[model samples]
Target: MHGLIGQLRTTPGGRGEVVAALVEGARDMPGNLVYLVAEDAEDPTSIWVTEVWETEAAHRASLDLPSVRAAIARARPHLTGMGTRVVTRPVASLGA
Candidate 1:
């Protein structure tokens, strides 16, 4: 399985909106096993996203999806910066 974990820094107090857009965009995506969004405990404007997919190609293809494109555009205004990101090849997982 292919997976990704990333952190995003949003404009002050804007994490909720960004997270909402991301979640909405990911809905019904093919090959998506997991799509989880989390808020940082200490940083109100920081959001973390964890995703698992059946294959790397599916993950790449998601970027071209209309809902994903729209979500990115809608969330752009509130994005301050991208933080750390890491790609992973998952061997096993409980949920995904």
Candidate 2:
């Protein structure tokens, strides 16, 4: 499976907007397995995303669409810094 993990520091009052963006991503994307999140207790805006895709190409292809760009832009205003990494790993079971 192909996967992406991202970490982001959110600006003040950005968390709500970011969450809305994530929800849109979930609703719009086609080949995504899941988008899991973790938030910092001290800072509501500090967040991480662990996203699983059926294939890397599918995720990359999604980026070319205007809707995906718009969804990403929705969170841009709230993001202080972010990083994403893609990985390829063997599937051990259907659980993955």
> Which is the leading candidate under lDDT?
1
Model 1 residue 2 CA deviation (Å) reads 0.6
Q: Which stretches of candidate 1 lie over 4 Å from their true place?
A: none
Deviation of model 2 at 14, angstroms? 0.9
Worst 10 residues of 1 by lDDT: 87-96
**C-alpha lDDT of residue 9 in model 1:** 97
Q: Estimate, for each residue in 1-96, the C-alpha lDDT of model 2 and write its tens digit.
A: 787777778898888788778777666677877777777677776777777788888788878777768878888888889755546453643654
| Per-candidate TM-score against the hidden true structure | 0.94, 0.77
Q: Cα deviation of 57 in candidate 1 (Å)?
A: 0.5
Clashing pairs in 2: none
Residue-wise C-alpha lDDT for candidate 1, range 9-68, written one tens digit per residue:
999978889998998898888888989999989999899999899999999999999999
What is the alpha-carbon lDDT for the whole of candidate 2?
0.75
C-alpha lDDT (0 to 100) for residue 5 of candidate 1:
97
